[model samples]
Target: MLRHRRAACYRCLFEEPAEAPSCADAGVLGPVVGAIGGAAAGLALALVHGDRTVSGALLVFDDLRRGADPRIVRFAPRGGCPACAKAPILPSLSPSISPLAAPLRVTETS
Candidate 1:
């Protein structure tokens, strides 16, 4: 769950006064509208799929969070990620088939 402090900070940093209204100012109607929209979307999904479980709800929540904020997608780094210098390179593509498809090299000296 997201904390109110972080949300407030994000609002202050990224949102404009005229364009972005504070959550506190939004009052009861804001939460109501959000709940209604979310429930409607979930109902639509359930109608289409005929199944809605805890995992499904979580997946929906994850999708919504990602859709709402792109920064959430990069929240955590993979354990064995070479680009971040945290792990060794693990190539998936063959060198002969696509020489140009190699990952961009970054020297530590620079």
Candidate 2:
């Protein structure tokens, strides 16, 4: 069995401030608004292809207040979670069975 380096990272996005507000009243559309904002941020990140230093970092957005500062939290992955378990090994394909396994040759052109 060959051991391979894992390139996968986990990231979570929060739509609200990290600290809870002092108000006792439960605001309406909080979850809906958060989901929409988070979705937009997630989509933007997915579509753009640059600097992934934020991978495995938590993004907290302050949608309720304009002046509030956004927050970012980074965490390390701990082994043992079934969802984050090691990926199952896949059977290798022979050259005749897999087109990608066939060799390719390149010729120089003047």
Candidate 3:
């Protein structure tokens, strides 16, 4: 597996502070608001992209910092997920794991 710690470091170096996003809330209401906000955003994007499938509506926000601070935002790689160089996954008969997902191309985009 190839790691790009250097690229990530550079992304952080170029980042600037942006104003607080509109999602701020306090206490128990915070999670509820975030969830609803995510769902709404997904729905709105789905309409724009012309994809209504459940998978299409789902947005995977991988916060490497895991919500440590909202002011900091890392860059998403242009190539997206690194899928192509992965070794073949053995089919999982276990119900816990879903059957093999469609293969993803990991080739680096120029």
In order, what lDDT does every prediction score? 0.35, 0.43, 0.37
Report each candidate's C-alpha RMSD, comma-separated, in the order given. 19.7, 18.4, 17.2
Give the residue spans of candidate 2 off by over 4 A. Answer: 1-48, 63-65, 88-110
Best by lDDT: 2
Query: TM per model?
Result: 0.21, 0.39, 0.22
The backbone clash count of each candidate, in order, is: 0, 0, 1
* By TM-score: ranked, best first: 2, 3, 1
lDDT of 1 by residue, 37-85 (tens): 7865776676557542321121223345544622221123333333223
Which candidate do you rate higher for lDDT, 2 or 3? 2
Summing lDDT over every window of 10 consecutive residues in candidate 3, give the lowest-scoring window. 1-10
Model 3 lDDT per residue over 7-78, tens place: 332212223223332322213356766875876676667656765333212234445758652332344332
lDDT of 1 at 26: 43
- Flag the better candidate by TM-score, 1 or 2: 2
Candidate 1 local lDDT, residue 82 = 38
